[model samples]
Target: MMLCNESRKEAAGLTPFLTPRKTIRLATWNIRTMYEAGRTAQVAKEMKHYNTCLLGLSETRWLQTGQLRLTTGETLFTKKSKIKLNIIQCYAPTNDTDDEKKDAFYQQLPAVLDKAGKKYMAILMGDFNAKIGADNTGYNEVMGTQGLGYINENGERFADLCSLNQLVIGGSIFPHKRIHKATWRSPDHVTENQIDHICISKKFRRAWKDVKVMRGTDISSDHHLLMTAVRLHLKKFKNTTNMRTRYNVSVLKTKEVRTAFHLSLSNRFQPLQDQIENNDTNIETQWKLEARKEKKVVLNTSRTRAAKAKAQEDYTATDKEVKKNIRKDKRDHINNLAKQAEEAAGQGNLR
Candidate 1:
């Protein structure tokens, strides 16, 4: 388990991208069957331990495809990806399985691939039960020569599907030790094969960082956990809450604005000033009333400025014009400062 964890941590540093919009650590494991007691918790525990966001489970032994929310706070999507990502998790028929069953699986496979069109990024991974072998031969585009075992009938079908869909077999591209590449082992521990696999769209081939099987995971299954790190580009959403709408107090430096503000303040207080003259009402009370009215006027002016700032902020946020405006404003401020400094120097005001 310690070895498994150290290797999983090493995968994090293997990412070569300077900036990834979003990173997803995904694992595909054929857990044989999820019918055993505490099986769900055990799987969830391992998932959380490795800090994996998404997991593709196979041979779940469930009757139909459906989703479930685990008590551990992870939502299992047994079928789909909500975002533009198309994730297809499947369990292919073994070599010994009936030919009719295999034919049905291959037939349905193309239909699913068609639905997850080439326009979007798709991840097709599961216990394929096919060994592509180290001999890539004419299949160099879809797979690599680093594969294990010899090519079989199932391998031919898988390679063809990948070629047609523009999907690259991720596991075959990276060279790893045989122990790290092998996905399944026999009871005697001598027999091992790289049957399970992960494949990604060829268009986003650079996004695939690494692919290897985690043999040290504590899951009680014949198949080891196959994982891959992929960098996915995501759309960023701006948060508008708590955006500062405070008026640029420096605007008061403009003579015209200062004059306009003073005029507005006088106009607002004129009525209060007149009321004070006409009141036989207590002088102190009149003064308090005038103060309250003055405070209201100031508050109203501040609110008007705030509304204008907020409107500008909203417009810039939606249009993404904030950076441009800020650059322009910076240039203007620098020019003004330089002009003021030149004038001061002309006057010999060194201080």
Candidate 2:
């Protein structure tokens, strides 16, 4: 959505709200498993319906964790920033899972949390499969008594992890109807629990406005979509060189426009030409002066035309090169993932 000068002018009629850099609508959804036919498309279509800017996914069941580029010119899991806002998506094993496997999952969380930019925002969210009960206890700063089920072993560990990492459990902090708070429902329609969660860095606690489980979307999954409204003002540095003022020279190509331009120039120069003829009466000198004036006009017009052409050419070339490099990066990223998957499979470790 970053536009050059040419495209900006062409799209000047667009509303200001259409600007790409603005408040983001972020959501986290454990889509169960996007292995079903047309599942990715279904998720993408729902994302569009919600006008989501960033969406964290879990249990994607992708062969290997890697970046992907959508056909709509957006990249997933490939953003880089100096002081970026990070979102760590996860899918924890259930309470019945082996202790060793669960320990391994928590063991890896520190690395992910630490990988985020220290000075920026970080959101830890996903289907943790840990039920945090309706008791805040000593963790008043990180959670609330609004949680659903009773605290289990996994919930204690999850709360401890949040306490250690200075993260606030977003879901527990907001008071909602029990139905709205519950993230997952059993197939029997009798058991409802808040296993899925969205957490934000405690440092940015004020930025997180609300968190709720949405049930309107029928994504064919027991888990509901958890959305959080986090106020973030994205700072954009304008490239001054790309902010040049340009005129619509193509308008001059029209017959009526050309006639108008010529008539205006004629009216201006005719008076000067008459004055020169009356005062100097030197034909050659008057001709030279008029030629100089006309030459100045042509040079000014030509320079503008040339500048416009050069800008467009540069934009086109840069765009082409960018697309080409992006395709290469996608290929390389996927290849690396494939290689990692093969290595993991060879070692009998495919998690």
**Model 1: per-residue Cα lDDT at residue 286:** 50
Q: Compute the lDDT of residue 108 as modeled in candidate 1.
A: 93
Q: For model 1, how big is the CA root-mean-square deviation?
A: 23.5
lDDT of 1 at 147: 94
The clash tally of candidate 2 reads 0
Candidates' TM-scores? 0.60, 0.58
Clashes of each: 0, 0
- Compare the candidates by lDDT and give the number of the best one: 1
Could you tell me the TM-score of candidate 2?
Answer: 0.58
Number of colliding residue pairs in model 1: 0
Question: Model 2 segments beyond 4 Å from truth?
Answer: 1-23, 72-75, 78-85, 233-351
lDDT of 2 by residue, 1-351 (tens): 111122323322322321234455667888878789977677777777776656777787777543554554334452223223467777899999999999999998987788874576788888999898989888898898889979998998899999989999988888999989999999998899899989988887877768888888678988888888767544668876786789998999899999999988886677468656655223444554455555445555555777767655655555555556556656765676689679879999655
Clashing pairs in 2: none
- Model 1: worst 10 consecutive residues (lDDT sum): 1-10
- Tens-digit lDDT string for candidate 1 (191-270): 99999999999888888889988877877899999999888654678887997778887999999999999988896777
For this target, which candidate reaches the highest TM-score against the unseen true structure? 1
